[model samples]
Target: MPRGFYTEGSLARLSREFDVFGPLSSDPEPWMTAELDQHAAAVCESITRDAGAVTLQNLSSYLQGFVDGCRERGWRSDSAGYDWETLRLLAVCRLAKEHGFVR
Candidate 1:
């Protein structure tokens, strides 16, 4: 599938657009929310501590677990679930890119 098929533009655009929908309150889906935050934090910490070794590929590999987890939670056929996962991953990747983990 082509990129942006999920929405229309970039993940950043989708994130901004999602905000108009409403605030994302805490839900029972820990794997989709808090788990994503924790994973992002851990990835950032690792990247900061070892910038030389933490590449985008490394970050991507780590993120795959989160993606898989999200899929298990409900990302398969749900647009909302896909959006949440995409938003979380984009935020994490953006941070990694800023820290030089990605080009």
Candidate 2:
């Protein structure tokens, strides 16, 4: 699938567009929404410290390069129950890109 497929909209909107509508389908599952704000704050701090800022100009390359680097650490963001920090990082990035790559 195209990268746009992942970042075009909130999950619910996508599901609806594809004819997969239901109450259980939404922007994020309840568990993620509960902690997303905190995770976003942490990601902002981390991105700021490491690369100054994660702007649209660099978001794609940053994500690509970060994924490469993560391979060394097992790249288990989607593994089993999921690693919260890694999962949050991706969630945060997806949301950032979804929102037009806001800095």
- Best candidate per TM-score, number? 2
**All candidates: CA RMSD (Å):** 7.8, 7.2
lDDT of candidate 1 over 14-73, digit per residue (tens): 334433331332232555556556756766676567564656566655566666687677
**Model 2: per-residue lDDT, tens digit, 1-103?**
1122232344334333222221213476677565666766666676678778766544454445555566666654334343554455445555554556442
Model 2, runs deviating above 4 Å: 1-25, 76-80
TM-score of each: 0.41, 0.49
For model 2, where is the 10-residue window of minimal lDDT? 16-25
- Model 1 compared with the native: what TM-score? 0.41
Question: Would you list the clashing residue pairs of candidate 2?
Answer: none
Q: What is the C-alpha lDDT of each candidate?
A: 0.51, 0.49
Q: Which residue pairs overlap in candidate 1's backbone?
A: none
